[model samples]
Target: METPTRTPTAPPAFADVLVVGAGPAGSACAQLLARQGLRTVLVDQHDFPREKVCGDGLIPDSHAAFRRLGVYDEVAASAQPVQHVRCVGARGGHVDVPGTMSVLPRRQLDHILVRAAQQAGAELHTPLRFEAPLVEGERVVGARLQGPEGQPPVEVRASWVVLATGAVPQALTAAGLCDRRTPTGTAVRAYVRHAELAREITQLQVIWHGRLRGGYGWVFPGPDGVFNIGTGVIGSHSLEGGKGRRRGRNLREMFEDFCEVYPPAARLMREGEVLGPLKGAPLRCSLRGVSGEHWGRPGLLVAGDAAGTTYAFSGEGIGKAMESGMLAAEALLHARTQTPAQADAQVLQAYAAALRQLQPQFVLYERAGIVNDWPWLADLLIWRARKSPRILRRMAGVLDETQNPARLFTLSGVTKLLFE
Candidate 1:
């Protein structure tokens, strides 16, 4: 159900910035803005500590964001330290690439961000679904929210409206901001609680198998003897053959095949108890879907998955999502002193410029995502990585983003792997 366009009977609430969806992006944005003394309001359809489907792998980028946000110790306290990413290939050749990484369930990680935002003086409003953006003469002034039951519609007016909703296209579509209705990809994950499973999976494990045509599987060891195991395919029915290069099976078949194909997953399902039903979520990636104009409109800015910040090859979103949110916060803060129209112009230009700074990296990731279709490439890379210390170092560099993956996964690179 949708809230009507008519003005609300109650008095309108105001804030300096209003953020929708309290995921990592929204909460991170709100916290940074609030920390800078802006009257920020963060709203979400659900409450904190709710379930969120994710691989939950916090790589180096995530660590950098946590430190910049000044909550690394708080968030890392609940995380399980992971040293390497065990990349298993289709032909069984594998390598344990070293990195600074950890896995923390989204249930815990998101709550930490929300609490951090609140601690920074941002007002947290939950159980309020965002209906539409409140626009004043084509510039978004705030949002129209639909509260529970017959609690009456609430109009929140702000100088800026930030849409940080992850992957779900409904909010963007409702606000007439969606260019692509379907997500570029989809993923499913489930939590399993077993001491042996968690103990065995010390590294962030990922398997690339032939059975999974346009995707791969992962088994991340989370905190307190819990593991998050999942698979992500680049295409669904509607998204088939677009970036995936081929169509993939349904999420059910994908999960089943992943469990049956990977030894770790097979053991996880056979011995450990699945904590809950398998949860599925969409992934918007490669910076494709939304246009640059939509990324930052007058008085409106999008961050996280809503702005396609997730990496294509690795399926890592947490770090990039937080980065984009922080960037949006920086943009708004930089332009806070200008007049309404002038501020909107400056912020929009700043967001656009900021996204451009990150575009080259996303393009490289998309280029490397071709390995999903040809699992043999992973086998070759792993095989070479095992033989040469240089290759292994390059693999580790890719994890830390100190080296470009495009340089590691190309025809010339493959030739060097064979000859060197």
Candidate 2:
């Protein structure tokens, strides 16, 4: 993908709808809206084909969503297939979950999605920094933007504004539609090139230990001979007191230590060539009222990371982020046909209902995250899962989201694991 042509033409004064940030969420939302002839304008501070810090692993659900967007083929052209996921417990129990995933760097994935949005009739604006939302009496009606220096700032008015500005959430914060302090988690990743591992590694591997029970380290296949290696830990993980809590290193320090001490990961990494400096980012786990609200005041909607769509345990959010954007577009398209006085209320209500359906699962994942803080339990479960195909299927279900996460916490489930 080449750099998107930066527009030097004068900016439009208004649009039917304004989308902030051109990542997965923003681009997906704009594509749907514009395809419906909504005169959408999608803006981002960075140009296309740019680097984004991510795991670059798209789970099965992400493929499903991409197919819905008609870009799965394009993604597949540049992606590597992942056939399974392997989990290693600190107690030396290993369980492999069979599934399918795709690995595509965000630099390529984001560009493809943005191009799709433009093809669907959304106006693309690059290098346009979002300043704030255009609000009136607590209602967000549009957005204010600052272009390159030396040019005057521009105000683009619209009937509605959608904030998809990712984890940092500049648009959501500027509108004052949510919390002053966004709760967040952190993750760091590095690129490693191991010729043998690259050839033999057809699955995604995660290492879980008693020391860093709250978080896990991963090795996912990347293009060519590269492997995307990373570790993640939520801020609240440090506050949880459990058997796994032994007072060890910080996240970055843990990553360094993990590369040295964790045999499965360390062995492969030791034989690999380091490609780039480690990159890290704060993750917003869609904590309602803490990160930001999904349905805000009239004429405003927050999708993707800005709306806290990321799952808690695995931190795999690409699918959920795009899912939220698609839902928002559906609700907004419906609202557009309604009377002006009723549109905002109606859209908010519909979007809220859609979000409500996902709340239970999110809460369940949060519980799983807490449970993961206890490595002994994970060790037991993985060991049990290795013996029973039934348990193994259930465990794999949790990762792929095919089953309710609450099932893992049920009395029957625990009894079956221990004695069955």
Candidate 3:
């Protein structure tokens, strides 16, 4: 792939929808919009095949989303299917959760999606640094971008601007569209190539151990003897003595400590080589709520991370991101048929309503504090289930999101936890 070069003269072109960020969210939105015969342009700060810091695991819902987007075959071809998940507790007790999932290196997965968007007729520009939103009256008209070569910045004017910028909501906040909040968690992860355990454990595993109070370690397997291992802690609990940066233990150190306790993992580490840097990214537990008031202001709409569609428990953002992206595209298409102000309101409302309706369970789960506010409860459940095969199976169903938590916890095997 060629790095986008800045020309002395800006390209004189316009698009119906300008998508910022070419990751899964932006690519998905761009693909859907372009397929609908809308002129779409997808922009990213990095070139194709660039590495993204992630666990690289795709859940069953993600697979379903891929199918909906007509890219399931492509994703399946590039990824290794992960059939089961194992959760290990701090006490060395572990529970195996059987489920259908897949693991793909982010580099390969991201490139495939970008290409898919391009094939769907979306114009893709990469290595283009996003400057700021171009505002016309009270609405966002488009965006300003500068290429890596230091040439004059180019302006992209569009009927709608979709912000799919992941994780960091800075761009949206900077434009006075969203308020920024401190991330509630931080994680560090790195890829390792180990041949031995790669042969022994073909299933994905999430191991929780260490002094880190509210976090767990994970080992997600990928193709070619590769695995992603990492640890994360709730930011609030990670702080030491209520002080400075040095007060908290870094996730890398916690992961190293975990490896010391797990003999099998230790053996793999001694034999394995790091494939990349110990990458870290913030995990936002709470985002400025996704509201229609700020979502669609004239010509701008937000989707994916920029729209706070991330799950609080597993930090699974990709599936929600793709869902939001597709919904945004549909909303934009709806908007095109109406007058400007009316169109904006209709598009924004449609996007927001679709999200709320599609994931009503998530909203309920969020309210119940399934992942965030109940770490100890989660740990106890994992520990108990590990000792009972039948209970483990029930736990697996819950983790798979196939059964509701209320139903899963009602099982006689799991109800023992209440008595205990």
Candidate 4:
């Protein structure tokens, strides 16, 4: 089926900055740039209030971004506040940890931010497919886009281009700005409306169960009795072995088995209605050589998933994407007076340096065993936490991003596990 289309009043010339993708990264960058008096245009393939597959969990850091964009109140109004997180381990062991978190469907969240950006003077276009970048010499000047149906192609020329395209990184790859790498695995997710199930498991919970190597299941609760239940597995592991000798098992089958084991989840499956078809996509942790030299080529800059900012372990991308988009806009504003070459090399360099300083903390956590390396550690910790509440609390602090890794390792209870 052809994509839907919407047309706005056409401008005589191009915008100062053109952002491709209307996700958190694109909207955040467009709003900040427009707020600073730069003429910005934000375009997306799908319209606002459209659904996107995600875990629907938001970290504490996400609150800060919402506040900066002046949409915190709107988001809070639409989302469910989650003060506690319950983590279930293999063998039915569970640990209930308390912290500040929230969940909201992306349909509501994306619409809020895109609207905020438009209110801030950004020109918005929806259902626009980005065909390719307009290259002038080695520099990317703008992008070529086609609307739904036989509408003529429109070329948007901009002094600077910000790519907030998600995990696909299509813009970057198409422009020859960076090489695209395959993700380690795919995440499959589906939404369900389960009011009765919500009453039973009111707390936001992430259940890691089953024997699917390199994969785990999660049940994240959202507002208005909605929940997202999903599973993910490393592509390599899924290819290892299975009955019927199929190439690999799909996520739906794995999720079916998971629900069978959990009573609360089983009840939801029996009564809850699926919101839509199950969706899946590849997940990438980090990209090699993500600095400005790799990402900033002439008039273009990549941010968010396009820049490989997703955390390897938890698959968290929103907060980091917002941060990267803001930094890119800041760099563009700083380079407003310089020549294009100077702007690309110097101003963009500063943005890369800033990102490098901030990225280590994120990268370290991804490498930490909690997310990726050790399945046993999570199970063992959850099992132990059933007996020792102090240990569970400390670990919760780490997962909540309230405490540093150094402090986390120094905890006596955690240190005991390390030495033992």
Across residues 259-376, which tens digit of lDDT does each residue of candidate 1 receive? 9988889889888888989989999997666655648578889999999999988889899999999999999999988998798788988988898899999998888887887888
In angstroms, how far off is 182's CA in candidate 2? 3.8
Off by over 4 Å in 4: 1-12, 234-249, 287-294, 369-374, 387-390, 404-420
Clashing pairs in 2: 286-308
Cα error of candidate 3 at position 118, Å: 0.7
Residue pairs clashing, model 3: none
Tell me how far the alpha carbon of residue 261 in candidate 1 is from the true structure, in angstroms, after superposition: 1.4
TM-score of each: 0.94, 0.92, 0.87, 0.89
Evaluate all candidate structures by whole-model CA lDDT and list the values in order.
0.85, 0.79, 0.72, 0.73
lDDT of 2 by residue, 1-420 (tens): 366645445447889988988899999999999999999999888877788888898987789889989999999988888877887778667788887687888988999998999989999887888897887886777888988889888899989888888887566667776563444577889888888877777788877776675677888887777888988875542334766553333678878767765775686667889887889876888445433344576877888887878888778889988988998999999988788779988888888889889888888877667545665666666777788898778877876778765555344445556976
Candidate number of the best lDDT: 1
Judging by TM-score against the true structure, name the best candidate: 1
Q: Which whole-number lDDT from 0 to 100 does residue 358 have in model 1?
A: 90
Q: Once model 2 is optimally superposed onto the true structure by TM-score, how far is the C-alpha of residue 22 displaced, in angstroms?
A: 1.0
RMSD of each: 4.5, 3.1, 3.9, 4.3
- Model 4 agreement with the true structure over 49-135: per-residue lDDT tens digits: 688777878877788888888999988988888887787766677778877678998888888888889899899887777888999
After superposition, candidate 1 runs with Cα above 4 Å error: 1-12, 237-248, 292-294
